[model samples]
Target: MRKHQSAGSAHGLPFSPPRHSQCGCAPARTERCGGLRRSTEPPPSSRARSLRRPQTVDAPSAPGGGRTGGRLKAVAVALAVLASVLAGPVEGADWQAAVKLNAGFTTMSGITHRGTLGTGERIGIDIDGEIERHRTEDVTAGVGASLGRRFGPWLLEAEYVWRYRTDWDATAPTPTIQAITNVFTNVRTSTLMLNAGRTGPFSARWLWEAGLGAGAVWNRMRSDYIERAVSGVRPERRFKRADTKTSLAWNLFAGISRAVGQRWRLGLRYRYIDLGELRAGPFEARPARLFANQGAHELQLALTLK
Candidate 1:
């Protein structure tokens, strides 16, 4: 038995037919099964929808899978960058509890006055030693320590500045000795100070402090005491007089500092000193007074401990 499928536009494309029979025998030619009938065409809307619709395909799954894989890749990159940064050194970084050292030049400035050597204003000596005015400037150096913690924009530090000053000079017109006394000398002075300061981006660091400072000064004078030259044969005897005394000193200070590195700073300060009075035994039988106004200045270098 044979079957025929005469396809036409009546049912559109892709339409086919197959005849089926259970028995092995075919029906007679006169027996017709539903021949040419009314044209069955889908509506214009349905046809247009079928044309507009796209074929669907299932997407392939990646081996590593979904958004989780992309996220992991991003995380890995970030970690690599972080590791590189950690392997490198950073400047001006904070370090807690570290030992440090520093040394630099310094200078001391003030008005040095030479006081009287004798009690009498008028005597056989034309004039008792006058309080002569002179200026002292020299090279100095010191070493100190400090500890700090950063708080926002403020750097809070507790510091102990142990500074030393050398090269003290003085000259006075003396009546105790008939000749002009050419005085040349040196002094070593020390101070312990506490400072609190701030560093700005454009301006230098500023530090203001108030603390007690004590110093030991040694003064060397050229002239010796005059003895009553009674008989030229008698030797010059010792006089019961002094030119030196252990004195008490005090000061108030304001300063500015420059940070040379993470652990070092160089500072310059201006202070008003009230050293009160000092006494030297031999050349000065009386009290020798020292006074300094705003003209007093000090330069120091410091090491950061933490």
Candidate 2:
């Protein structure tokens, strides 16, 4: 029988045992040498392992991720702070609501009129005249409500007030005509304001406070003018107009208060408010416009439930 030969020997190639690395690891395959070798360096210490940062795989991102999420979180934090501020006072402080009755006087200034005076075309007559400036004063009264929060001696409030209708009148002789020009104006006003102020001890029984406020005022004015004949030569001409205007308003106020009960307080406040301007149209026939700068000094008796 023929002698059996190994494949490598038959091919005239030498076959050797698998080689080992200097670190005592074996080669994994015929072509690769010592690829599975253990590291020659010593093992990492526990402290070193603890200090190494953890490796993390990247995760798929959602729509509007990263920056958007950060912005949303910031906004949420801001709104929470604002809500807490507006909802009430700081810890161990008071939140109050008040109903107030105000009685005061309003002064009218810069009252003037301009444009033509007469029934144009139909009466076949028109006259121009320089009317004298007029100023008037009237009594005013109003009712109001306020909601506020008190932080120590500081207070913040939102208030709404409505004043009843008041009338003003002025008459002057027309320079160019034998007529007395009379202007009658009826005014009604309402305001909404935000106020900030401080209160401190005045006496054992009374507390003193002062504040400033700014807001919008809605003024409704109804106005009419009459040119009555001082001499019978000219006929009486009457014109009517009505208008509403919104303007910026502001006030300064000071007050004194006394505690009525555990949850009640009675106060008297004086406020000086700029009511902006009163304006009325250029009426038909008379074709004249009216303007007045208006302001008020108000004394208010407020009953508050704290």
Candidate 3:
């Protein structure tokens, strides 16, 4: 009966906690329970949560952009300079090629060539050849080869040329012998020269050159002499002269070179030849010593490879 009564205490009733607490949850009851137990867990607080710093964002960057920009700038500058340099020469070469051939009169300031008339007569009259008399009026042709290299505005070149001319004439008579005289003169000259000059962006080319050279000029004169024969018969005598001399001479040339197109070059130049003396050649008898100076004019058309 006692055991039944003890079990019946709060047995039929639901589990209960201290009435002073506001929580509906209750501690387990002991026999004749008189105390309450405290909970170890903590309640939720009302304080606000801390915010995380906003993550820093950066713009998308191109890979290798800086280095590529620098390299591209350098390339552009180099190309611009190259283009400026080549532009003028390509255009100038074309025009230079077409009108390369030129013709103009020349005057030689040399002394007269005095040779015995082959009549054994000492003819001392002035034998000066007129400006219209010598090989000054014939054709002037030259084969030119120029090798050049350039650095900045300065340039250098080596050149070689060959020039030739000949003249044949009958000198009209007025004094000693009143007969038509036949004369032939031949001149052959070769030149080697070094040049220094300047060039710019637009095929503006110029050069100054000087040369030391040697050449030979030959003059041949032929005639027949007449003598009064017995009983009004006129006999003829054969008279001839062949004269040649080797002379050391120098020449000066100045010119402007223009580039018209890719393969052509145009140039205009003036030339001067100094033939020291006309009487420098061999004469059968003691010859007269006379000095002479010769002048020339030249033009050129050149082809370029670049």
Candidate 4:
């Protein structure tokens, strides 16, 4: 009978008991010398042992994860801010106020009537009269101011304009009377209007605006004239206005505005004024009448408060 025993290795693999040295086998390795090994096989090299060992690899960190997420959050916030600004004022926002001062040229046209002696009573003239269409134009200038409130794309305003030395000339026709007449006038007007408009960014530092409106025009006029008769024995007449007259008119206008500061702007405007017909005299106890139609162009400087 032979004796038998069992053995185990740290790697948990089982093997035969080492043969006794008398059986021509190498001695079993001891734990103090780094544990047992199979005598029939060479020990593994360090590189091969490391390869056989199970390995755990750490996953790579995300690429710029925190920094990229931070940048995206910042961009989202900036876009939200910009959208609010372009959407206009919020509900219940306070009203805004503005004042404008303007100066520019004006032109006037239309008809005038003067009677030949004793040709009156028709068309309500008490003396001989002639009607002529005046196509003449003049270089006249004015000052204006306005106060207004804006409502989204609409604006409501009140304005006053003062016009100086608006004048024109015409030649009277035959049968009634033939003559050349010169006229001089002055006008002032107050108006109320509602306008529709839009505002947009023009550049990094400026904004642009455009608008249109219709309103009433009130006119104050003065006249001076020299009339000379043609092909008739009637003597020439020279007159300086001894009185001023008033008329109600209407107008249409368009304009553009540019922002120059936080509360200042510059603007250019064009207007078509219809003063209809205005009458201004009974000189020397004799009946006379002047008819006029007028228009203007303007540039302005404005200040605003919100």
Candidate 5:
């Protein structure tokens, strides 16, 4: 028999074929055997191993976290309460209360006298060209308070006011036929009124107001007469008379105001008032009567709270 060439030499291959593992699988194809494939990659370097290790990063802290967050919340709540307290009620509130102080310049239309003076029935007498009159111009001060409700841009209020006393002096001729006589009168007046009004805004910080009022006025008058004998026919006579009267009164007013602060305002107003009639004697039969009608210009400062 011919000598059998070695298998490798017979194939004329450069190298011998590799043998299979005992498991019957080639090393490079071991995954086909049904188990996980072994990695053929080279072992990792030191730096690579460090990068692959599980990382533990620290998280960033919040600006005001933990106890600091609690303190911040408390501070925010305190600021809110302070703002409310300092500002008072907001603009949308419907109810308000106010107080005002006023100074006024008043002009009075002179009194009108009616009914004839009888002989010796003379109440105070005057005989200056058959004309009798009493008039006054004065400066007066007053105070007022009000409660109001708002509807849209309109505000309606009910107010009460007290005006201090005012005084006037007048001179007239007496009607006594026997002697040339002169009468001097002193008058004082005080007033109390209740008013209702509506106020509306005209500009960003300005408002207009109008009102009607009804109330009472008290008037006190004192008269002194001096008589001179004309032709020395009658002895000079001097006499005095005093009277007090309470009368029904009414008024109308209009004003414009500018806000001074959150709760205060400054205003200027004009008013027309009528204080009924004043009688020298009782109502049924009076020797004389005086009509008191007046006009006033006022400066007012007010405070309102809601």
Candidate 6:
């Protein structure tokens, strides 16, 4: 009989093969009666191919993540910038409530008499005096106040001003009437207005402001006359007072303000106003309009509270 040989080696050996079989067993242990080598690996099952297939792994959201995360971050930044723009510059300023007081001098136009008075033939009453012909410009005193709200650089205010009485006296001689004649005229004015203004930065510590206003004016007038005969005649005095009249008026003004403290300011202002035609007396059927085409120049010192 031929010598038994193990399948692990090319040459068949009578004793066990020197090398082990590829299936991890010694050739002598695996050899059958015909000296055939038995495989150490088992036969493949149906699921074997599926187990050796490639596997996929998902990556974390980092540098190379999807564009969805990047888009979300960009939208957040845009919303922040939009919120800042809508807030506006005045949002940080503390100028919600404002009040102002002012004291000033007012110079006004004089009055002229344009009518005649007939007096029953003894002595005709006439307007013949310096008081009726000359301009009554005087340095009249005044006081005023304003209350309002400030909106950014703009202001809307309600204002009131009082002007003290201004008077003029004159004496003249009339032909055919032997008497010393004198005339006295006086007037006072007040105003109520709605004003609008704008404020702007000037220098480091100064702010410039300008405004325009329109409203009604009140004018009150009184007139008195005295007649004394040169030849020991009794002196007769006549006086007349008229009811106050309201007329349309308007003004324009400008000023520069300096900050005094954290919540106060002081300013110097110049103003021009047209106090419309004011008419006053008709004493004993002697009708006369005392004032017409009136105007005033005002210089004021103003204090503002914020």
Best by TM-score: 2
Candidate 5 clashes between residue pairs 3 or more apart in a chain or in different chains? 125-174, 126-173, 126-174, 126-175, 127-173, 127-174, 128-173
Error of 5 at 238 (Å): 4.7
lDDT of 5 by residue, 58-101 (tens): 86432334654454455446445533543466466477677888
Clashing pairs in 2: none
Residue-level lDDT of model 3, residues 1-306, one tens digit each, is 011223334678643444325544433333332465443323333111112245779964334546645644554464455346434464223111122243323344433444333333434563332222433344556565655545555544445565554332223221243333333344444444444455444434533333332222222222222222233443332233444433333445555556557555555565554432232222233232222444555555555443
Best by lDDT: 2
Off by over 4 Å in 5: 1-110, 118-129, 132-158, 164-170, 175-183, 225-242, 281-306
- Residues 1-306, candidate 6: write the lDDT tens digits: 224455644555345544444544333233355676664334456335534676789842223234534543553454344335434454544343333343444444455444332222334564333233445455567778876656788866667788877664545544335555555667688887767789999987799989988776777767675555455655565656655666667899998989987878888878888776655555554353344457777776878887
TM-score of the candidate numbered 3? 0.41
Off by over 4 Å in 2: 1-85, 88-90, 114-128, 175-177, 230-232
| Tens-digit lDDT string for candidate 1 (221-293) | 2223333333544443333332322222344544555665665555555554332222223335434333222
CA shift of 110, model 4, Å: 2.8
Q: Scored by CA lDDT, what does every candidate get?
A: 0.39, 0.75, 0.40, 0.51, 0.58, 0.60
Deviation in Å, model 5, residue 193 alpha carbon: 2.9
Q: Rate residue 215 of model 3 by lDDT.
A: 29
Q: Model 4: per-residue lDDT, tens digit, 1-306? A: 232344555457675565766644534343333564334334567535644677899964333546645644553464444345434565643344566665555655565553422254343332234444455555655555665555555554545555555555544333344444444445554444334455555565455566655444445555565567555567777776644433334455666666666756666555555543444554453445565556556565565554
TM-score of 2: 0.65
Estimate TM-scores for all models: 0.38, 0.65, 0.41, 0.51, 0.50, 0.58
RMSD of 5: 42.7
Ten residues in sequence with the least summed lDDT for candidate 4: 120-129
State the lDDT at 255 in candidate 6: 87
Q: Distance from true position, residue 73, model 2, in Å?
A: 28
Candidate 3 error regions (>4 Å): 1-104, 114-136, 168-180, 201-254, 258-291
